[model samples]
Target chain A: MISRRIGAAAAVTALLFASACGGGYDAAGSANATTKVSVTTFGCEIWNTWAISKGVYVKHRLDVELVRSGGGSAAVAAVLSGAADFGYVNGYTAINAYNTGFPIQMVSGANVNALPPAKPAQGVFVGKDSPITSPADLAGKKIAVNEINGINQIVTASWLKANGVEPESVSFVALPFAEQIPAVLSGRVDAAQLGYSLLGNNNDGVRSLADPFASSNKVYIATYVAAKSFVAKGDAAKRFHEAMTETAQQLNDPANKDESFRLLSECQKVPAETLAAQPQNAIEAAVDLAALDRMAQQMVDLKMMQKKPDLEPFVTDFARS
Target chain B: MSDHGAKRSSLAASAQAMGRGVQSLWLLAALLVVWEIAARLAGSLFVPPVSQIFVAFVDTWLSGSPSSLFLSDQFRVDVLPSLARLGLGYGAAAAIGISAGILIGVWRPAGAFFNPLIRLGMSVPVTALLPIAIVLFGITSGMNVFLIALGCLWPILINTYDGVRGLDRTVVTAARSMRLTRRRYFLQVLLPGASPAIFVGMRISIGIALVLMVISELYAATAGLGFYIVSQQRLFRFPELWAAIVLLALLGILFNAIFAVVERVLLRWHRNVRPEGAEGH
Candidate 1:
């Protein structure tokens, strides 16, 4: 009986071995093929969400299925595991996955950080009476990020470095956005990096500290990514990119401003009034090489990666166009 | 002739023990070998080789000073915090569980009052109360402790209650006939009688406590095994991530082994009264 069980186990192992050695499966090869896009209900993913709600992909002769994956890391996982044809994820997440030998390639930009005069989407906040008046004061203090090794942390690290503060000096506590304000309020954390959506949630005791993304000249907040193998399949990537560009154009049109925010608020499950009141992000469809390179360099600086790879290869031509 | 017979049995027993050890470990060893071979052959970045994981584990957690007993700085920062929370939470649970259990067992009215509540507490997944815990305790270790203690309370309490309630009636009658004081009755008769069941509950709760510790630490934690795992996963350091997971498993085993030793020591008298494989009285 044991020998028979061993035989079955060996057979299973052999099958796994065979499958492992097989070539990558070609996906989205047919024109007008249904493409599964993993999206998160975040402000950055507004473009992709808008595209889906407005049937922009269908208009561009592409069938798109929007799979609501939670968070950037999950979206990256969805795309990498072939569970989705493409994913809208944090730009840093895509680059990090690529550096770690994943087959991910940036297909198009999702959202960009607003330049100075316009507030960035995210910022560090502290209690009104906090001793930490500026980024320099963050040294030797505990601060909260939504996730460690996430975009929040990376941006905070960048911002800290820009302000002559060593990122390592400040201890980073990982808390979900909902719990961050309470942590800060309760003196459990010295400060917290929070999005503008939660700004209304803060009471009179809260104060905005600094804009982390403001350190970068042009930061692509998020990007749509796909596996290199999937991107290589015919003109499916091109069609998807075209659809995203059209989506951006339509959203950017003044006539569609109210309608865009409504779609975004619906997609994100946030109050439409709150969404409209928030600062607008730069709507970018084409991936900017300089901005992408800057993010890769930041990852390298943060020691998240050994060295930045030549990102030219990981970006689709359609994304650049 | 008797001495010779004892020696022969001892030798046979040692041989049997060795055989059992090999039987238990062979599957694990085989699986490791298969995983190593399959991982190398597959060459997937996600599924790293076992050897790589071991190396990463040592590099990440074991590169420590001789003064710190070879435990890395990372261990103090990550693992020690988790252990502290687990200890506080588990310790609180055990103390409360045993006391409350005894109260419920000794006083039928109290038991009746708390019966439904205990059942409700046990049935609900403590993780579902994470938001409420965070609200009450903020993102501090208090939140983690509260969740862990709550999760571990039920098993220990239920088992102790069962142990106390199921005490032999003759023993209680004998204690009463001896004109024992209330304190003496509890110490000499009730405590020992119900200890076996109490230990059973505690043994079950150690696992529960460890689970709650990890779950609670997964969010709003600066330094913990869960935090380390999440950070490594986010960094896409698969080997390091696997190392943290393996460390967690080792920690669980270590806790179980420690529990076994304590259980053996505490229940030694009980074991002497009732030999292995003997029918229950």
Candidate 2:
């Protein structure tokens, strides 16, 4: 009798637990029953922060879940897998995905080119007292980059090539971003490639070498992309795009710039003043087909992409004013 | 047996062993050759050949500056932070998992209460919890440790529970007959018997802990192996990415070997009971 009672209780407990966890999706769906949009970490922390803070979803009776991914590549993968409705990817990653057969299209622009000319997110740095000034001087010097395949290295490679330096002329080392400044300060590396903010604060003994973006004549980087299937399936994607465009306008407004910077700082855990001082590297919210095509061409030239994709057909016209 | 028959049997056995060994070696050699050729054919972007990767690896690890390809202190700066996190997170998981597992196994009410929770936890993907963990702990070592623990806890807890519950009833009865208290019974009878299961759990959790450690680092980590790999991939440095992956695989093998040695040392008595050829050592 005791065994029977224990068995019955266990069964009941298991059933209850199963129902509770499974019911979570049902409840979430019913609550909004409206559009559900998925975004990545970069979008969540920066682009989506403005919308989330203003209760935009609540106002529209929509649901927006920020899905964190490894990076732009991972975000694209999520959308392709049907795990996310939308993803924010850099132009390079989006083009790479499209070439690889993922039917994704850029819907709207989140931010315009915020990076300074010749400098993308990363810039080569040398100790303020170091004699390594020109790319030629780096021939026998050690250079540090965040990763071998990161924007820092890509810009560094392009910078070296443009300066008539061989790709292997200087030794390249991979180090973490946080450690790059210290490494350069300690004279561990002759030069290091780092983000603007790291060099801005004088956190370590480093100064920017050359801005790669300045040489490239390219300004806009990163964009928000959505799967073609989602864009076609429902009006939910269109609504999400509208909300994003509205949020971008708010971020662009001069009156809200301070608040926008603060939110960005809070989300990124950086000092608001530091972020505000750096050149705004964000693009205005609008998909520029030509800019995207240029990015794709650059990727092809750099051998990151196998072929240049026709991006005009890939961009969704949901935001056509 | 006749001398001829014995000789034939010995020859067959030797041939079988030799065949297996040679096959394994050939498989390994083929994989390396294929990888090298494919990387070379893929050119600089999709894949960087093993030679280029080796050059990059040596350059990154040894050279302090652009010109020289020699070892430097800079490598430690990138490698140590990740190792430190792994150590702390894995250690915490091991301690908590064993303690909780034992408690639940020994106490009926505790087991009933925790069983459902553990099942739910194990089923929920660890990546899904990252956003919440980040919000609560922020982007620090604490967040990585929490995620690692979440991934490692289930296997350890479940294994420990099974280990304790499966303890020999005869041993418990004997301990009780001698008027052994609950504490004494657990330490003297239950723990020793449950050691094998606990070890199994630990082994499973260790692998999971490593994966979680990397995953957490890959996302928001300011430092670590996963951060190293992601940063490299982002920069489109295929060679450096490959090197980091190789290093991670080596680390995983090293951890597993260490755990196996520890398991063998602790469970020496069980060696006699284990069937022939079944003992890992």
Candidate closest to the true structure, highest DockQ: 1
TM-scores of the models, in the order given: 0.89, 0.53
The DockQ of each candidate is 0.49, 0.09
Deviating ranges (above 4 Å) for candidate 2: A1-33, A55-61, A115-122, A140-142, A170-174, A203-205, A265-271, A319-321, B1-281
lDDT of each: 0.84, 0.72
List of clashing residue pairs for candidate 1:
none
Across B23-118, the per-residue lDDT of candidate 2 in tens digits comes to 879987788788789977754344667777778777666566655334445467566777788888778888999999999998989999988888
Task: Provide the fnat value for model 1, as a fraction from 0 to 1.
Answer: 0.80
Candidate 1 docking quality: incorrect, acceptable, medium or high: acceptable
Q: List model 1 lDDT by residue over B31-109, tens digit each.
A: 9999999999988778799999999999888999898888998889999999999999999999999999999999999
Residue range A87-144, candidate 2, lDDT tens digits: 7776666676676556788766665444453235546778888888888888867677
